[model samples]
Target: MERSWTQPVGVGVVTALVGFTSSFAVVLAGLQAVGADTAQAASGLAVLCVLQGAGTIWLSQRHRTPLTLAWSTPGAALLVAAAGLQIGWSAAVGAFVVTGALLAITGLWPWLGRTVARIPAPLAQAMLAGVLLTLCLQPITALTVSPLLVAPVIVVWLGLQRLAPRWSTPAAFLLALALIVGDAVLSGQGVTLLAPVVSLTVPTVTWTAVVGIAIPLYVVTMASQNVPGVAVMSAAGYAVPWRESLLLTGLGTMAGAGAGAHAVNLAAISAALPASAEAHPDPRRRWIASTTAGVTYLLLAPLAATLTALVAGAPPGVIESVAGLALLGTLAACLAAATADPGERLPAVAAFLVAASGVSALGIGAAFWALLAGLAVRTVLRPRDPRAAEKPRSGRHARV
Candidate 1:
């Protein structure tokens, strides 16, 4: 938190670490889902990272908030859906545009923003609980195939997290990397040599992609990812202009179109770390960390070759397993706050389970549907609490 010697650099560093480590797979899958070639997918990631980074900086500083801007996780899931529908890149871009527009619309209308903001804390807690469960599972899943590699790291990380809160994640990550490289050296395993991140290109939208892939991508990203991303930030205590942040991401994606970024929306769970961490306690300083992170991203993201190499060499299992373990603290903290109230915990948990189940009737993800379920439960159980029934007279979701 201080200026010199051991400042808030950790926040930015951690942000970038989490972004590249966890987000790489998501971006690759999303781009591939939309029919992008390896080159195109890499190009898109380079561009997306820069724009997303820049958005993080701008949003954090503008509001003096600590929020980290990130690509949509659910948006990636949307791409998985896009794959099922056999959509094209042109449509994928269009979906991003649509999502950007929807975010803009939500921001411009106070009612939508407020209504979304008003989701009961308990339900939010429940939703976050489910999110944490899924996240915690990633590392465990990784161990099934590579117990020799992942198990020891998990055990060490858990111990470190318990003993040293501030240093746990970074330390564990460093140790994991050491283990990864060490194993290669000792056993003569095929240790991959990684290049650093460098390069940039913008996005180019096509009508066909927009009409097909883009529309669905946008709907799912905004409704499923952005809404909750913003919700996560708000729940953590940073009051932000949702529309402005949305617009920033939209503009970033637009700028990145030529560079090849896809489905750039707010990051929900990952962003929560910097937005609420002790390193970013003074809300204004968070802006510095986030902005610094964004600027760092914009500058470094162009070199996909380097980033890919650096990340890939770590052995996918180690990177993801450490990632899952690192996030445990954040997940725990969120649930603690979300379930502070005993009365509302059940409905909240139910709503969260619905979201976590990944059951989608339409082309949308469960985030939106889960919120809807929670609202319905609240409406039914607490009839007299008119806030559940009355729409915000002014913002985005005020139609009724």
Candidate 2:
């Protein structure tokens, strides 16, 4: 009996550890990129942690499935890419709210979910790749700018990637944390710990933000996180409660939006950690693993302010290096998916280039334009249907 409980509990702990440590830097950077000051970013991180934990616990308990929820990592990456849009913090919060509303709508209306699904895979993947491009290149840039501070972290990451692939990013992030602490001590600016506080902002919706932020955020979160989450659960032989999951995540996203959190959705990659055989051989009990993970996230919420403060003090490029390393695998996967189909390559490439260019026109960001450009190129390059030119047969004597 002890073994049964311990095994799943261990897996749950690891799930939360890996999930949080591996990508928290990226989350922080993304929040900061989108006009959030350090305090606001901390609040965002804290609220996200709380919501993720709460949602995971509620879903797993209600459904008796290892259903885990996570903050929208790709949506955060989208925010990072849209940094140049100059949408103020309040507008960004408004966008988050709009994204949440859309998610709720998708859950309530099946056709909306179908429409989001119909966004061609290659185009969505290409757009994600383009957004990730600049962030993924940060490690290289950091190396050039501060090799002494960055190289050791990269070495540790590479070494662990070979030895224990799953822990590589976390290991690098830990090393970066050490560096940040050491620097703080050496500079005579002792690290200060503060209670995590949620700083609320009254969101101001704008047309530019809605076009530039909300729509793309919704698309990326749905495509990269929510849809894949369902597939992951399906692969694990569990039918996810899709509508309920969406409603919960949508509510969670909106609840935290005013506190700087971007969006929350079903976990994609990390969902497997709790749902898989690794969590429990008897799949019926795997919900415990998710419950443990949710509790862990709640415990970690209080540290968000401290972590954000430490990261805020770290030398330029150090923390970014960690975030960049964290995203490299995601970047690689997106690229592979974007270029997988021969027929879609040209259009995907077009979308990829436009998004990576960081160009904005008419106060709209590149991600939205990337989709449009890809569709336009695809339409132009598509081969004509032979049936269109053939005369229709109308009677019993016709071909039909």
Candidate 3:
């Protein structure tokens, strides 16, 4: 049966939009948090989009599978929460470079990948959940500043999430957009367009950025984004080569960081969109949707500056609120994943609390400390008797 182009093209466009509107604000805010000027921030967005799109296209073609590439959303949140106002942007860029290099190593070396896999998943997820805790407060905080503007956006987001789950994020983004632009137009102060300009920055490596940003960014990108992204494709029955895909994204991340961008990685939520039956009935043909989505990303590249300008022009409260709303679903999912095991609850909770504390020492962010603290507590609290492991099996046999 010959496949029609309609589904592939339509799904591709939708997938592109989902990738863009969902986390673009987080990217911008992350860049700004690290001390990016408007030009640098816009350039980072442009470079990130291009690299993600290019990487997706290349990987999908090379592997003959539907592969979706994306920037690390959780990593962006890490930046927002941990971009030590003192470390400055150059050091952040250096951290980004280090992260990319680490990602590449994970792909190239089987031992490294296995070692990363050994990191207790519960602790990793708990750390991510804690990192996101503060940003999740934005919507509520925004209400105190401008309820009239924020209330409607939140209502629409919540309403659509139940009514049309897939469209909820885009709808929320649109509502926020309307409010931001509408206010500008009505007040006789029209929104102005700013052309994105690329400005190269030589990254300055520091112990602070290496410990505080690079390590955590690499961890979250791997655990929170790449791991689930692979699962999404595997669930859809696409035999993806995880190592090669990681290598491509890691290289792309390196290129992107050269232009002030952060990590590029595998798509998690959006991956299934292009790989699903909706994209194409025949799995082999689904690559068309991913490639088309890549083209759409390239097309949208020029608008990165405008998007940054829009975000910059909006009130801080509104921007934070929108970002918060965007991440609510992710936070819930992370929390659930972190606590999935009954036995790991204590360690996970400890990680969560420490991460949520937002403490930094000698420039290292709280997320790292949280993981360390959780592991230490888990070790101390664990049963030292070797026979403890046999008790569970014995109980099961007795029941049988």
Candidate 4:
């Protein structure tokens, strides 16, 4: 499973692309959601994208697994709710610092890592299934909105998947882009490109943004993003250094604080795609994908403006759909995993429901809540079921 250089670059490009805007777009939306001025939001985004990409690239390589890194997407979605609140930039940076520090501390704590390691694999797998289900459903359902626009793309994607499995999505994406452009030219309706925003407002340190925004950012990114991101790596055959990864995330967030970014943590689903059978079947050579992505990121860090603007201009539905669709395979894998055995079925369903419910009672995300609830149910029901022992016996037959 040793990856060659070419493998990393190719996989990295695919990974880099998802970040190109999906990361920035939602962050910008978050800033607006919280009522930060255009400049402040953009600055924060700049810090976020750069640090996130760098963190991802670095760890993804070090782990030699399909370690995808991403800023907290749901965090942005959360921001949409917080928009119109008056939060100062300094406070926001402070929150980032706090979150980073917490991550570092937790990562270094062997107890926490060991506890996480104890979660049954099927339960962990179900968590992924829940997220991917929601993500993929978003895009597939898009066809109802514009079948003409979306159907052909999906049809081709399906055909390509069966006929040329590896190239399916990318090929479909390129083909869709070409057709969209061709229609624009032939119909004499060129798409309007917006000017890239390049605001540079300095953040004034404040306590409010820290308490209100920063803490939540840190909480969700680690609990939501980092947890599952690591799961994908482990599933793909990498023996990860949990503490080291935590240090990288902490450092990444620190870098963001200086640069005016939000949160940067491991990527879960999309990064897994390149690492999965979809991108490359060989393992040894896959680290190249993250390496390639890192190089692409370092080269483009300077062009943050152009990149953000382009994504900003693109239809919101497009990117959301893209993410949702890209996650379809992962979602299917998860769904099948959740109910593989009779004993874990109910608790796994609880995990899925809680995660999908999107409830955040104490600054933590539903994913965390789901796991907790499911675990509680499982613990309560464990002694009663002779079938429960079926799980422990599983490790003997665990896959590489």
Candidate 5:
């Protein structure tokens, strides 16, 4: 009763397409924001893809789990925000190395891992739910921008979700690809292929970049990406070695830093693609989907430049529609998980609102702030249920 390669392969292909199509442009923009020239940006993208691809392959196989890895998209956004803080891309690279080392150290230390585990599940889900809520609205927004292109994509997705839930994401993804490629063909652009150039720069450290860029990158990536990633995997009933996954991703991040890429970590949304019913019915066999995704990533490394160009030139609404459509299921699940605990509803709502507001305090992103606010609210305004706990009686104390 071995599962056929068909399911795993389909899931793998879906995961890769969604992963790359969703945020690869953001990554390129992040590099350019930080003063990376064309070659450096292309190299950074190539290195990141290769590292995550190889890392995903190794980790999923080693643990026999569906552990897909990805670059820190939130971290990329942070870099984009703090682009002017660093002198050059070299300084950013230094910060990247430091962030990776910090993650590696955290993995080696059981206390830190335990501390992360201690975070309330509701709060974690709230943060993820909040982040996804904004992005998941892209379909509606894209409709306003280009109804002809986006409306059909959403319709196709909804239809597939009702008729064949497992294939909805992949089908939507294939349709988006076709639409984009078809547009290119009609416009006579014809899917131009630009070879990726791999360039490495020696890292230069600056205290400003370390404090401003490194700390924020680490915080956001861990809170927004890795925490939700682990939550997604766990919810899917896959028991992964959190410490090991962090360590491998940390090493990969360091390896890619010199090539101008920032941190890499566990994926939140894309990981679900490989772990869902689409991958395989048997949980034990789902690892193949992640492994296949890794192979797909490796194959796409050389095409980073081309992919980057395609996305950059394509209609903005189209890209957003694809990403938003792919994340719809994950968004719904996160929302449900966040509100499942009635006792934690207030704090979770607070977290969700703050996270969705896209606020950044000082240098840190809203996700960290949301977590802090939620915990504070939960502690200060402890909602007491009369049936929950009882004080010891005076008579019992006397007897003791």
Candidate 6:
């Protein structure tokens, strides 16, 4: 019993640590990109920490499964891509609310879930790849501008990628943190720590934001996070209560929206940590791992503001370098999936280029347009035979 408790608890702590540290920079960048000030961004991060922690605990215990919740990292990447859109903070918050509602509706309406599922894997992957491109390029751009400050971080990341792939991003982030602190102290600009506060904003809904931010955010979260989360748990031999999980995460997203959180959903890559055999030899006891992760997230919640403040004060591109480095693997995976099917390559490329272009028209962002272009190309080029279109393709399903 003691051994069981210790092993799962330890794995749970690692799950929370990796999940938080690995992507918090992207989360902060996304919030800031969408018009959040430092305080509001911190609020977003803190609320997300709390919500995912609480949601994970409830769902894991209620279902007796190693289910974990996470903030939508790909959705955050989409927001980072939307940086130049100039959507106001209130509008962003409103989009968050609408995304939550869409998630909940998907849970209740099977048809809606099926509709989102029908989105071509290649096109979905292409959009995600497109969204990730600009942010992933930041490290290269930063290295050109500040090689001395950025090179060591990339070196550490590369070393870890070969030695311990899972730890690469976290280690790179720690090194970047050290560099940021050292630079600040040496420059006589002391880091100011701030208490975490859940700063609430009155959400303002708009047609532009609804189409621009909310719709793409919803599609990304559903395709990338929620769907993959279920598959991960299933692969672990646990049947996730899909409706319950969706409702819980949807409500959590809404609850945090006023506090500036973009969205929260089922964990994808991080879910494997707590659900794996390494967490516990006995699958029945694995829920303990996820429960522990939830508690760990709560404990880490207060750090959001201090970390946000530190990154805010860091030299330009320093923190962005870390964010960019953290996302390289994801970008590579997306690109691979986007180009997997020869038949879909043209449409996928069309989507990828449109999304990467970051173009906006009539207040809608490129992600929306990218999907439109890909689908249009796909429709024109799709096979006439229904049976042929339904034929299974040989390869792994493309996931964000």
> Which regions of candidate 6 deviate over 4 angstroms?
385-400
Ranking by lDDT: 6, 2, 3, 5, 1, 4
Global lDDT scores for all candidate models: 0.61, 0.91, 0.85, 0.60, 0.77, 0.91
Candidate 6 Cα deviation (angstroms), residue 379 = 0.6
* Cα lDDT tens digits for candidate 2, 52-75: 999999999998999999998888
Alpha-carbon RMSD to native, per candidate: 6.6, 4.6, 2.9, 6.4, 6.1, 2.1
Off by over 4 Å in 3: 1-3, 390-400
Top-scoring candidate (TM-score): 6
lDDT of 1 by residue, 1-400 (tens): 2562134566677667656654465566556666666566677777777778767776776677777777765455445434544445655555566556556666677675466546665666555455446656778788887788788777776787679655566666666767776866776764553343323432345544554445445544554467777688889876657677777777666656544566577777666767665555465565666666677676656566544444455565776676567556656765675556554655677777875675554544455556678778766665354574364322212221
Write one digit per residue (lDDT tens) for candidate 6, span 294-360: 9999999999999999999887787898899888888899889889888788999999999999999
| C-alpha TM-score for every candidate | 0.65, 0.96, 0.95, 0.65, 0.74, 0.97
Residue-level error in angstroms, candidate 6, position 188: 1.2
Misplaced by over 4 Å in model 2 are 386-400
**Taking the tens digit of each residue's C-alpha lDDT, what string does model 4 give over 200-273?**
43445455555445554554565457777767777877656678778887777765654555666777766676
- Judging by TM-score, tell me the better candidate of 4 and 6: 6
Q: Comparing 5 and 6 by lDDT, which wins? A: 6
lDDT, candidate 4, at 393: 46
Tell me how many clashing residue pairs each candidate has.
Answer: 42, 0, 0, 19, 0, 0
lDDT of 3 by residue, 257-350 (tens): 8688799999999999999999998887899899888888888788988888878888557777878888998999989977877667788899
- Pick the winner on lDDT between candidates 3 and 5: 3
* The 10-residue segment with the lowest total lDDT in model 1: 391-400
TM-score of 2: 0.96
